[model samples]
Target: MSRYLLVVPPLAGHVNPSLGLGQALVRAGHEVAWCGPELHLRPLLGAGATVFPTGSRLFRPQSDHGLAAVRSVWDRFIVPYARFSLPAVDKAIAEFRPDALVVDQHCPAGAIAAHRLGLPWATLACSTMDLGDPLAVLPRVHEWVLGRVRHIWDKAGMPADEYFDLRFSPHLVLATTSRELVGRDFPEHFRLVGPLLAERPDQPGFPAGWLRPDRRRVLVSTGTLADDVSARFLRAAVAALAPLGDRLQAVFVAPPAELPDLPEHLLAQARVPMLDLLPHLDLVVSHGGLNTVCESLAHGVPLVVAPIRHDQPINANQVEHAGAGLRIGFARAGAADIRAAVTTVLGDPGFRVAAARVAESFARAGGTGAAVAALARLTESPVTTGPSRSTS
Candidate 1:
């Protein structure tokens, strides 16, 4: 048996994947603990999990698009969070004495701490952003991010000559995607373990009976994190789906506050058991988040994606390129455009066929079980001292 510590951010998308991996480790007779903000972790992890709390802060909210969004993430959140969490991570390592650490790509402090202590650690690539270097086309923007990373590295008092990108682990990298969707080759160290989808806590009181046998089922969600563009896009979605009431039923993952005047055929809720509901869905209208997109494809459900910010555009493009979905402009798409995209995905049998192909690829790549074996391998390997480069 080995002890594994997961260093993660407060955000749901980042922490959710680790839940399955951590649970699998425990089930395999290993000890697992988390290092993150307790407020968010407690609910998601339940009462039994051990957590080394890192507290919380009011970082700047990301609400921009394109290059601005990329800059906002690094300048406002990632860099500052790294500086703030480094000490806590070091402290966790001191007390827990974990055999290996599993760090998320977004939390560079975890990797830095592991390197400082000569501990074996693995990187968790939860999205497509870090995998293909998608921002390589924008040279200046890419350099700007590197500069921010250097700032954190220098502040940690590490040797300037041994500078390495802390976002990637030297030993192993677990990506929550498949090569079929990535559409590219990856390094041997990088394991494309598909989505780590464990059974999440159920969101009770969902009127499952509301789903009608006569109408096709569609789920419209922009994800948990709210943005400036989501409000307008959701309103447009409501208008688009309202007219198709007779043919299909649309369920929006929106609170009553967001849409007070929802019609009879449309349902609005603050939360729904997404994993539990995906099997029943025929089509998904999404903001192109990796989790939602992969989950939809994993269940062989087609999609109509409107990318909002960050890595969403890339994920949406991957969906379209794979022939599993269609992409529409998030900022410019109106009711007609959204309705047209949704209708096209549902009308085309080819889209469903493509989705099934992606699902098969995900199944072949394996999910939580593959990730568990990778982490176990890391724990068994010798812990190397100092900074070393791994294919990122």
Candidate 2:
């Protein structure tokens, strides 16, 4: 069994996919160790992998401004991550002496550490990393922001451009997203592995009186990161769907802290696993997160997406282009708009059919198990120099 060290950003969306792949690796008779914050320990351990806590920082909201929030991810999360976690990863590499390093796409520290330690490394991209065509324009924006942040890193005595270079470069890059949205010529090393989702271990009992009811069941979730903004949208959606109360049941998977006062007609719960809930769902209202989008599609549930930031808008665009969903801009969305989007999706049976077709495609693409096999191949051959392309 080869020893593998997986380093991931502490965000749930970023970490969850890696955890799914790590579990598959463990089941295949490989030893997997995850180095991240303490919050990830339980889930990583539950997945049958060893966990090493590296950074003490928790992922808290860094800004209230919309686009500024995206920049905060780099300043508060990425910069600190590179600074604090590199030493920990370097130390772990020295002692564990892993056969290969599997890192999250954004974690340049892991990739560089593996290079310095002379071990093979690969990147598991949770979202779109290839910044070409529509995405190509992002580098100029990223560079502008990095130029400002570089000074901080320089003050901290870290090589900022070196880290950025490592982050933008990868030996092999695997994205959970499909090519439907990413355009063509996406680099030979980039592989579109269908979304890596952990198979749900059975959870006991559904919400009390949570019957399928007479109307179509629509699951509304915003994922963990954007739950606050999602909650506001849910409230608007619930208000819009109030008239269709008996005709449509809206289930909002809210965080306990942000759970809004809901009308008795609409069901509200904190932290219901979407994997366990999707089978019963006819449609989903979501933020177009990669995991949520892929999971809903995997379950053959049509979507009404409200994209806020990052790759969400891109994912929403893909869903709409594929005829599986409708994308609504969150910045301009209102009760009427949310209601109209939901009605349009539910009213048209074509959306459901398209969703099912995509679901079939995703099933054929292979999920976490395929990712595990891919990693194992990397371990056996050990791409020690330059970028290696994904044959998929």
Steric clashes per prediction: 0, 2
Model 1 misplaced regions, further than 4 Å: 386-392
The parts of candidate 2 lying over 4 Å away from their true place are: 41-48, 58-60, 63-66, 129-135, 145-164, 181-183, 200-205, 225-231, 255-261, 386-392
Q: Which pairs of residues collide in model 1?
A: none
Give a tens-digit lDDT track for model 2, residues 210-272: 755677888877766554555567667767878877678887776544545665557766667
Worst-scoring 10-residue span by lDDT in model 2: 383-392
Compared with the true structure, all predictions reach lDDT values of 0.88, 0.72
TM-score of each: 0.96, 0.86
Best by TM-score: 1
TM-score of model 2 (CA atoms) = 0.86
Q: Highest lDDT: which candidate?
A: 1
1-392: candidate 1 lDDT, tens digit per residue: 99998999887888888888888888889999999888888878778889998888888777887888888888898888898888888888888989999999989999888886678899998878777788889888778878888899999887787778877787999999999999999888898989888656544467868999998899999987576579899999999999998899989998879888888999998888888888989999998888889989999999999988888999999999999999999898999999999899889999999999999999999888898998888888786654344422
